[model samples]
Target: MWENLDRPPLDGRALTRALVDGPRGSWSRVDVVARTGSTNADLLAVADTAADRTALIADVQDAGRGRHSRSFTAPARSQVIVSALVKLPGVPPGSVGWLPLLTGVAVVDVLRTVAEVDAVLKWPNDVLVRGDESSGYAGGKVAGILVEVASTHPVVTAVSGVGINVSLTEAELPVPTATSLQLAGAAVIDRGTVVRAFLRAMGSALDEWRESGWDTAPIAELYRSRCDTLGRRVRVTMPGDTELVGVATDIDEHGRVVIVPESGDTSPVAVSAGDVTHLRALDA
Candidate 1:
């Protein structure tokens, strides 16, 4: 019996044990920390030595970061801040780009099924739900995924980080275009369950990807299915103030977003990295 002496954050012992107790278990271990600057940074620091499939979940993130080095922080204990180390010893470099997409799928699944919340994905890494978009914030951000590849020589290791707002109330939202599971009226708000589902889904997706010779078709198909970015007008902001306004068409095999731009370029532009803002609904 685990007793919370003083509003315990999460029971690491029980969570880790439950992660591997059932047949669907995918993680080797799940470690919970009271507070950390960033779970991704901590995992990446030891990814070289850490066992594959080890996950680090934090109850408090003081200096979390998101894509493009943007600072990401939330009220402590209100979000799920977690990271896992994945070792792709012989996987093709071409397939590494799918990590974030795969993570997005896992999250969407967990949100919809385990948490009973309708979730959508912004291209590349943002997790979104319907909300106000007037502030250049399309669909409220409910979660995010960040995948960092540490090496390629000896073995390829990627630290996949995920942050999901679980219990944050309306008043606690980081931004107007942001929300939490509670705000969305989730049927269940168990952080442990969400983390477990994410790990299992990711592990299953990774297996399918590797078994297919890093073939991205399966993941891409599924990702596209859940992606809200596709089939919508969008603005992709590149470095140096470059921008492309287009209709997100597809996620190409290489994991780049293929968009039919409103610009004169008839060919679909494949974007590998940039800030994406979903624009108004495409004309019917």
Candidate 2:
């Protein structure tokens, strides 16, 4: 699904080639583009015609997107941008919404294994490393995941994109709280190794998801176990001018954040989409 342009292509070919040669349980076709506006956009452009297990990767995205349409920034040749296309079988239509969460679990698995760092999930789909005294929660955002789904007839193509900060220094971090493997004291990690580990992890997670449907309990537990947001005072901004301030309780079976509101309401509210802000801690 790549249209080779006249310009020199980006160097994602090495990674694409490696995955093609690596162990893939269900993945069949892998495509690597040098530069794209967004890997998600590229996958969507050809989603209707592409086969299952087709992976689209780019070296850098000029207009990468994250949850809530936030722009994802990756320096040229310093990060990993990979999107895998999968065809779901026998999964209910409504349950497809949790694919991103499942993919997040896989991302965490790969990061912990490949980088050998303590990576945590920050709700929804952000991977965070704990910050030390000097860094102070500038804990690196080692990786992030985004999934897009399209259905036609008997097959649903889920385009899963994962971005990892492999070699960026502290100065290269996109945000104050962001971090990279190098800055997190990880030795020089090979991007290709990280890519393969992630693909294998994703393949395993997808297999489990297809077999069990969207039972998000295991996925939620895995996420919560590595989550840094749990048990913290935070604000969740919902759509259309609604918000909730509460103690982050737990993630429910359907991948929703269970929150205990400030009004002392014991009933749990499931938050499907929102911006979360962790309250600052006061010194003792």
Candidate 3:
């Protein structure tokens, strides 16, 4: 798989040491694999694993997936793909709504500060950035996050799967709406740096979430501030192929998107799951 001998694979030992050595070290372990079907599936079934903060990094994700089980595949060694497992023993099931949103915040923060790119969250968990102006692309989806939850008798755990486009060039983009860190003029494309920064940010965000008992107000407010979907004319293609065009007004307390139709007096409709597109972005 890794053809580039010069590019180091994710250094699990170094990552674990860095994650566990600091005073704020919240991670219990880091594991790296040469290839895997899906880290989220692997972590969900890791019964022998201890209950703590654990991350699994892979060189090749042959069967990665996104929110709707959409295939998410990138060439080996071209991106930072990782899944972080977090166990929260006492958190109520309702609080789980905050997991994906908080994880998005973490990814956005790392992209902006460490990678020196203006990253924004697209509603649930897609990360978007503006590419170079010369490329004729204003903004493209650069990363994605998926959150899954597994429960044991005594505890509940969440797996946050993240994919960050690191060193891919324009020609290597998986889709026309997607771009990579290198193409976006990121200051660094070190996969290890990106992973470490993401873990640190996730740890901090999880702490804030737990402290607030998964309060939706503060988290929702923060997510709204960084979210690029709000105030945009959007199209939501629902599960049954039904479509609705409206302005994305807000995110309800249930983490559902509020869509106010463009030409109708219909009351706001909150959708739980759908494929969203920025109509204005497409026209731009």
Candidate 4:
């Protein structure tokens, strides 16, 4: 376990004490495993019985998946990989789509404060940092979030998986467009600390969301303020291999990215799910 001196194992007991046992904590349970295929899949497997607010972390994820089943893998202890089981009650079905966006907002806030990195959100739920021109790269994907519905028999439950690169070096990055906290010049790189802060931030955001009756206004405003894709020209690859190139104009009430096509139509299109590629920045 200690073969890599720099990449030490996570202290599960400490995490449980700080996040699950604290007075202001909202977690129902926290589990840390040495190796897992994917924490999100593990939680979904038990979604039928897993308690709400349950958090699962894996030191090494062999088959981590991003949006569209894109493989996201890293060296052991190289990232903060976790999944939280969230059960939403009294939330309207239409408003449920905001869960992932809300999660992104919470995570971006945590990264900005805890890691001390200039973090921002991209469209649906990607956390990114401003790229350094000297580094020969535009802003890279520092973290990616995947939200999957678990069940609806009794209530609306979903498993949200968030993977944040922490200690990966430039050569270790999964892709040239991917980056880690260390590579992003984070002030702190401790996995346990980052995980604890992320949980707290997420819990608080969920509480606010519920209190607002799943209202999208409050969170939407904040998300828009931090979103970098709002005024950029983007190419969205929709289902069926179709493509739409337009300017991202707004985030609708349903949390979809509102796009104004460059031509062929004047009406705006709202995209709920798709791959978004930022083409260029437009004048605000």
Per-residue lDDT of candidate 4, residues 65-133 (tens digit): 998888878999999999999999877777777888988998899899999988999988899988878
Candidate 3, residue 8: how far the Cα is off, in Å: 2.6
Root-mean-square deviation per candidate? 3.7, 4.5, 2.2, 2.1
Tens-digit lDDT track for model 1 on 2-75?
A: 24332247778877777766567778778999899989999889887888888999989988889878897776
lDDT of each: 0.83, 0.74, 0.85, 0.90
lDDT for model 3, on a 0 to 1 scale? 0.85
Q: Please name the candidate that would achieve the greatest lDDT relative to the true structure.
A: 4
Model 2: per-residue lDDT, tens digit, 1-284? 33423212334555555555554445666666667898887887888887777787776788998876789776676787888878887766766777887787787777777787778777777787777786554575677878777664577677877888877777777887777887787643676677767877787787776666646567666777877778987788889868788888888777788888876665778898887777765411
Candidate 1 achieves a global lDDT of 0.83
Using all chains and alpha carbons, the TM-scores for the candidates as numbered come to 0.91, 0.86, 0.93, 0.95
Candidate 1 displacement at residue 142 in angstroms: 0.5
Instruction: Report the lDDT of model 1 for residue 125.
Output: 95
Candidate 3: the clashing residue pairs are none
- Residue pairs that clash (backbone atoms under 3 angstroms), model 1: none
| Leading candidate by TM-score | 4
Q: Which regions of candidate 3 fall more than 4 Å away from where they truly are?
A: 47-49, 131-137, 281-284
